[model samples]
Target: MITAVVGMAMAASGCSAPGPDPGGATATSPEPGKSISNAGETASWELLNAAEITPESTVLRLGVTRIECASGITGTVLEPEIQCDGEQIVIRTSVETPEPGDYSCPGNNMVPITVHLQSPVGQRQLFDAACLDAETLATAFCVDGGVRWRP
Candidate 1:
């Protein structure tokens, strides 16, 4: 009786956000690009290179790439495939554009891939492999903020 009651209470007390549901629907990643909102004009802009901004500087930008793979046999598991060189990685970026103003990076239209980092175990990760696996390269792109899986 007490066990049953406790079980019911425990189940009721648990309130947690659900994980990604693979069978249900796959959430698509956002596209990379510049979003400009000035006056009544809303324009979508692409990332610019640092050299483009010789005397003019615009937005704050960052890029990150992460590698992910499918794990287990569930067919829904995406795991990090260890590359011959190392772990899987993806490059992404983040640009700082002030609201109500036009912003762009200085130097060139395309941001350089300078800083590279890896992800932790049991989580998504990224690496700097001179050449990525065929599967990874298929969905890689340099978008608004950084490189991401767009395949």
Candidate 2:
């Protein structure tokens, strides 16, 4: 009985499993001038092509793109900037609130916002924006489709 218990424990522990292969294949970086697309729930944008101009920024060639903001979300892009820190690139911009009472919400709140983009690999990549709510003072970048904020 003891031997049987020990055998069962060993089997459960996967003692006979093979370790990961050190010589396994690795992913290659994306080539320049490749087209990519990024879409969100309410809008989609396309990049005609991409070229990594700097370690901190990748210049995305603009193509025919359309953006549609959902109701209750009101703002205008004043200036958009791409900031890269290490392997991550965040697209941030200053937004100007619409004229007073233009949006259903009260008060004019102009906050600089950022959207995190997936590390540009090649010509093909994607980025997503989390939904926003004004009443709770929630920023974009929702977690699991729920309202969330980070200090």
Best by TM-score: 2
Q: Which lDDT value does model 1 have at 68?
A: 25
Weakest ten-residue segment in model 1 by summed lDDT: 1-10
lDDT by residue (tens digit), candidate 2, 57-105: 3234322111222233434433333322222222222334334442343
Residue range 72-101, candidate 1, lDDT tens digits: 111111111122111212322233322453
RMSD of each: 20.6, 19.9
Compared to the true structure, candidate 1 yields what TM-score? 0.20
How far in Å is the alpha carbon of 86 misplaced in model 2? 1.8
| lDDT of candidate 2 at residue 151, scale 0 to 100 | 12
Model 1 shows how many backbone clashes? 38
Give model 2's TM-score versus the native structure.
Answer: 0.27
